[model samples]
Target: MAGTSLAGWLLLAIYLPTIHGLRLAQMGTMSPNGGDDGVDFRPAYHITPPSNWMNDPNGLMERDGIFHVFFQFNPSAPIWGAPHWGHVASRDLAHWQRLPVALSPEETYDIDGVFSGSATVLPDGDPVIMYTGTSRRQELGFFWQVQALARPENGSDPLLQRWVKDPRNPVIEDAPPRGTNFQFRDPQTAWRQEVGEELGSLWLTTIGSQVSCVGAAPMYASRDFVKWEFFGYLHSQPGVVPSENETECTFGETQFGAEGRNWEVVCYFPKRVGEEVIHIFKYSDQIRGRTPFGRDWYVLSDVPLAFTNKTVPGQGNALTPSLRGAPFAPAIIDHGDIYASKFFNTSSGRLLWMGWSFETSTGCTGTCSDGTPLTDARGWQGLQTIPREVQVDLETGQLLMTPIGEVEALRSAQLFEQGGMKLVPGARRALPLKFPKGGSGGRQMDVSATFKLSDEASAEVSSTGFKVGVAVTHGRTGALTSVFLNGSLSAGGGGVEELEMWVDRSATGGATSANLQGGRVTLGGVAKEVTLRLLVDRSVVEAVGQGGRVRATSRVYPAGRGDWGLELFNEGAAGSVVAGVEAWEMEGAFVDDLW
Candidate 1:
């Protein structure tokens, strides 16, 4: 599922000196229009490294007067290489200032790479980090993985600069007791455990595993926050068989952990709604036909044993409750390309979930194609999906996932709005007659729309289920690469309704190259209404239906200049639906060049 595009790759031999006050920095020559389009493929509001590559929103902590954002970065080149913990800080999550490299590989334990990790700020202060280390030492002789710790050199800096690796590195020095290959990494944030011991917080770090080659998440726990012990499992997917000879399935393996989605990278977050305590479990799944090969997977379950703060070993629900033991099956977190998520509480008194959006694909996504890198001058790789507030939906008995309100602070203008519009079956209209010729290419914008089936079309809606779509950017050749959100087709009676999403990227139709893949997200059956809030960037589009009761996102490349056209589409019968829609042109979040 890896996709590539020839995005006018220009060679750059230019090197700029670091800006004053910044410790580590670099920049490459960038084109005004990233591609041939007037719009650049880079996200206007999302976070990407100033140069080179970035993956996984790591060590996200908001404290004091600054918000710390650490990520897996390859400062050496745009393509993946020796990984380092690239650093940045923001007071408002929107504007980020480049900081020195937080953590790098220098010690024998991490000579190969300083991998992904988490940040935990104690009650007294400072942050303690637990990360994975991989090495091939002269004495150890063979390559292996181990857990490590780090702390700020100047814990008082507020910026949290210059990390110091623990001399007693590889704290969890041994591998899992179960023979689950080198699947150990990604330590979760710890919570205080023990009946009375204040320092005895319960901790669990997950490592990838395969029982007979099926994916599993084996969690390890620690009480003192230093010495660790192997706990039990959180969940497992039974029939994943990794390709024996193919080796290209390594991109974002932990940086984004895309390769292990089918059976790896189990992330957990617990929350309580009203009187019900809920535990959320997420992982990637690609069970052949059940899921689209390129996207990530998500699931939720109940916290077993009501979760007590007892400090006993292997007593936390994470160690005892099986994912299958939950009330229902795993549900998709975001219908879009989001996975390897982390959830944590911020100093602002809000719990948030952030995941790496597989926006730009290279090599292979879930499955491989002829290995070739994409050429679009996106200049960056990977981005953190908009931060979302995670809570349990007591009414729906599911998770309520909504983009944080802070995201709205990025909208700079109100471009277009329509009080209401009528749609006939199989009818289409160019949006924003304000431009006369469709649109002048509002490549980055926000769209909000609510659709209702016409009373006269209820019979047709129940039988065929009408479709309402927005061609974010389409072509002049009459080709269409639009995202369609359709709904409920009944059988006979007592039928369930659903609002389903499908991104149409067939190249023969236009807009984008055929290599760009799209998939569907069933927002369940809808009775009559579907409210949508969509964020459209130059090459990316993310949609949230009914405040994230369902979500979907995808990366698309425009195939023609005329493809910048934005329009409204209807499929069913003429005058079958009515909608009230509005759109706003978004402003870029990264403009200061703080580096």
Candidate 2:
């Protein structure tokens, strides 16, 4: 009778797929393409230029009412070699228009490729981009920072034309003492006006590794964006004493509260905590300042300052509006992998965020690869995560972030709905849903669920015990995020067991992974019940689980037909309960979109 019943249910499942507008025949079982192994996962929004290789969003700024986003791109293939600045612009920050390669490796100064940089509006109101120019000669690679001026020949067709690099290249060369690791690169420039000076000041931050350390970021001040002078080290790690390398990401204006009275210079650095990589902030009241000496200077214990914008005719200047002593304790922005984040001052009056998606490795290893190393083939490697919009909750004082809103307008085909359902163990449920009706577009989508586990189960596991599977067909192959208690479980031979909630991108062939561990908690509670939110775009999967306590993100590129479905797995034995499964389609929210 059980066998007959199971067969009947299988037949019903097939029929339900058709009724729900799903093409079951087209959807295949777990494979690289059918599962989470590729870069074309359905996304909440669609990227204008499909895919090859993209990384580190550079020069993210608004000019002439258009938001320009430049990225480290290699158009030759979907790998990470031969970097160039790929340009794209969007009016609404959702739908994007791909522009020509803004900056390439044509000049001897930038013969290798253009690395990462930032952009600011010049005093003349033209857009100025400062970037690191990397060159290679006789198997040796040297990086020199450069700046270029760009203007819209036609205000209406900013995306139609190309950005022109300055004729005088190598505006800033490697710091003197050619042997020192202090090759100035990754230029982050911003304009500020002094109290008594007629002309405003330009602040630039670059990464350098001296003889004592590997990579440390230093700051410089410039009267003009073109000519820059080294100010001092923004922040450095322990030198030789406990010897560790420190590399700083982008720096920006730190704002405090709605009044925006206090401002400070905020920059992020990756510090090694045990074996894991953690991101910490350094702030100061001195408007134009650098990192001090010793371990005390290593941590930002002092209060911070406030920054405000002062518009000067065509030029917009960000001045040190106000200052504060410093926080009694420095704050850590994220415990997981986040690097090179750009904070955008959007028209909507809210601060936005875009950062480089780093893997467990450091430096070039953080970049994605096609599994095979570059022996002699000129193929591309990794890409960066799409730009995300960040939100800070005033009540709890925690940061919440998601991709920008414009990406959410591209959803089609809605299939499953569970208003409220109590999930039970031993029994798995499959809901009928429809895949978006179109060619294999980018795989980007927003997935969220509110879960409640049994008290006994929670006590036993310390959390919940169940797996959330996506894009599963008849077989059990697909990506999954499993949540369970913290304690160890016995497998069979008395071995300890650990519950893992992660997104597997093996189907897409892009090896990206994310997960949550027990001991991790946000402000709310011990993550008793979690709202697992995932943004699946192309080859990238940004999964925020357990209220952001556990973030498992990876990129996958699969090679199969783009057909997907959702499933739930029960890791627990019989008599377990999995309750409250809710999934919602999400849209991007821009700073202006928030009231």
Candidate 3:
């Protein structure tokens, strides 16, 4: 035992120094080991590269000019299990530096894994994190709940990177026992208290369900960042009849209406209503305490709200009067099979959102066992969408979201441009463009176009049938990339299918499908007419169709530097006329700038 203890001490002595050495290397300083090892890692802009299976991003906090983002990750295998908190830091939102895993399931309470959580500066001015603890026992079955406290290791010393868990964890685990029907989890913490109230009191929102029903977000208040008291049920649509499953990632602040005359809570949740996956919202006028209030407190019904909000106090709440009652429709932030998103405010004042982006099947299969075959076989499965900037419409109160602006900082130079192209029936043409000198000749490019389709041309194709092709080559033996839109029509079925395609230059000629390699989608159902936005980078592509539906992402790559061109095809054989097309040069940054 003594010898083993000595060996353990020896390991810590050696490992701590090595860890500190790596931290120093990241700071542009030489390591003590006499190596000039500086890391030059950057955040992926197009689509987050598949380092491994990444779920909801947690602990997104900014300090000392550095922004830290922690995510739910399964590093050992491509799929998710044995969850750990993966860490990455960025000086700008655009460029990211991957750090070591921040939190692992080292303790028995969290043996199953550390699930989703949030980060905040505690009232004592220390950095603290709150997360869910998942565990299993023969008697208890599978039980999980919210937990939190100050980081065990907190100081100004840059070399100390370990986070100590609070002794008194499972901080808010107040559900009614294991089989009692109520399941509670997901704690989002923020410091807000009245003048007379405790200074460090926190308001936490989480998903709770009573057997047979799902996803009723309950509220809890905490003081000292440890002990929590049940507040009340935040919001629920009792009679609306949830379709078997429902869950919420996070809830925004309580917005006060004009002159404090009204109040509303902003919550975002995923509801499996019937056969559709809908992102929905509900509003409230009264703040219920720990007890059940009258039916008037339930006056706010489940209504489809927009993504607009006015900037006020209460720390980035979605409640805003400025964007209330506008014609804006609820924009589907992600069109592909992505779900369970959480939004937070950055130090720069922009609203950023992150969610899990993977194919429906990959999530259902439990393990990301077949990485190579999955990439080759399933194509565009098991990846994440780039974080996006979210906004609320001033007139419609609906949400409007897009890729963050700082992402554009990554653009090296303009490769090509074409102003006027008219699409006619049964005829296809390619508009070739040249890459700017000194740009990444081997690197991929983002191709975008906005056009108006003629009514006569619209009548020929099915609402969901349209194809766009992009090719890149020096002259010969290059690559061909294609994006297809199908089943986009309304119930009646007759509208133009808007196209937005993200292509990868690296995988252009590969055997993998275009939709999976480095492609992404943002598609909408058929519309009378609409605008299209397409973003393609090295490993990801994002396409936003019309206002109705959005195909968020897919994967594809280009082979080599060559003449790049765009092609439009009518899959239904019904010719469509194109009005105009415009493409922009994109920019990449070291980190995302919130302002």
Candidate 4:
């Protein structure tokens, strides 16, 4: 509303792909008041709402070659509040068309707000949405939440613009006795199974909640979209202290509340790995230790397809007890600011994963953790991480998530390329990529590099190890964000060292929520080679190591409008060689208003 005109706002009703496709460079000079505020923090290629607060990617689905992304949005302000479902659609993941609000507070049950939910395709091929509706229910004695349903008015519309709320909404009328109304929400996509011709098919989904003293993802069974029955939780975890030996799935003590107090955004899916079908269950634990904001934790269980459909809902199947003491344990997918993750199968029958990357900069009126007043000046709050192709590693029992190949379409020019460079201990050299000729210098890019330990380095098995990595720094202010490969070699001929993908943001100039985050990088056993891929979009930094065995999504604020700097550094007892480095300047996606 600042620099945007009435006509400019009205232009949203007209779809103009050509106008939005123009590079940000050719979009003409920007003003501080305009939508393109010339702010360095506005990500060029990432999916952000046209304006205001946004979080938790929701209602993800595909039909007719077009993909749709819905999110928790506050249409009025740059901060969170009573939410509406904001939407966008794209034929390809790289380009998006921003649409109007999908669902708003209309009925008395949802008058307060419309929260997070998912979209599932029905048997007949039409997609239906199930969401959480919130309002003060006098009978319930508190602000309550319940499940609701919505369907596209016209199934033929690929964009799915107009949605009609089901009249019998508050579909699952009340919360299960195990959880309070306030705690039960985020109904995930439903899956169907054929159970003999007599029973036909059964639809099953889960909702996040707390039951008794354990955090749980409670399952629900339904014959039709309108009626749902509570079945036992698919998984649950009792509160416990954090231990290095335990998986991230184990509920840990935090300042917010006791572990298992509550869980949010429960997601489930099945993928066949070789001959086994690994059922993947994921949830967002907002009260987990180390991450006061929240973290997405997942576990892979080898539940047979027959047992899953036959005894799951009927016997109230709970897989936690069996997985707790097993080697196949729960793990943190992306160890950073990402949370509330959800997945959907694409038109090509590929499982694609996405998560909400919330803002690290505080929006409060008072000073932030960094002593700054506020950082919501840009009129946006969150974004969706680049869609990742998901696959289960049969050998390691881990999930492999890599940026979808569709993202390559955004690559404009090759920014930098290098190969076979030796890196000695204590050696630090700058790269030419810091200050590129066009676009925001090093702000928007796709970079991938491979590092291999030299013969001498691989021979040493010291108690303490080496660290080698690429660093992104603000040339004017020296603000730094470093992603490193930390490990020590084994005594054997082939290095058997266990490597980790560690991200350090302690020196980043501006406000940030987390300083250090990392995960074990399973480099196919011996860890002879480490590959690091980075997708840098202004304030957001996503790093994938070992072909997505480990990932880190961080929000970094680098101070200065001057050139950026990229450097390679090595520290410790030995040296490593940079096998290869490839980088490309990415083009901004057109997320313009479309009716």
Best by lDDT: 4
Residues 1-595, candidate 2: write the lDDT tens digits.
1212333432333223222113212342243223422223333243322234565677878766687878776655445656677776777776565566666666666766677777776556576777777665453333334433344444455553456676666666645121132234556545363423343445544443231222234455566566666544444322112232232222222111111111122344332324442333332221112111001111321222212221111112111111133222323333333444455556565456565553221112323333232200212233344555554333333345555555556444344556455555555566555444453332334555555444433334433334433333322344433333332333222222333344443332323333332233234323334355556554445656555434544444444443444555444542243444434343322222111
**Of 1 and 3, which scores higher on lDDT?**
1
RMSD in Å for all candidates: 7.5, 15.0, 12.5, 6.0
| Lowest-sum lDDT 10-residue window in model 2 | 289-298
Pairwise TM-score winner, candidates 1 and 2: 1
lDDT (CA) for every model shown?
Answer: 0.59, 0.43, 0.45, 0.72
List residue ranges in candidate 3 displaced over 4 A.
1-52, 122-125, 139-143, 150-152, 155-161, 176-183, 189-202, 208-212, 236-332, 359-383, 394-397, 435-443, 453-529, 546-551, 556-565, 568-595
Write model 3 residue lDDT over 373-448, tens digit each, in one string: 3332221224445566654432233455576666666666665566556665455566544556654342345555
Listed in order, each prediction's TM-score against the native is: 0.79, 0.64, 0.62, 0.86
Report the C-alpha lDDT of model 1 over 250-278, residue by residue, as the tens digit.
22233233233324445666666566556
Task: Choose the strongest candidate by TM-score.
Answer: 4
lDDT of 2: 0.43
Candidate 1 vs candidate 2, lDDT winner: 1
Worst 10 residues of 3 by lDDT: 290-299
Q: How many residue pairs clash in all the candidates, one count each?
A: 23, 67, 64, 0
Steric clash pairs (candidate 4): none
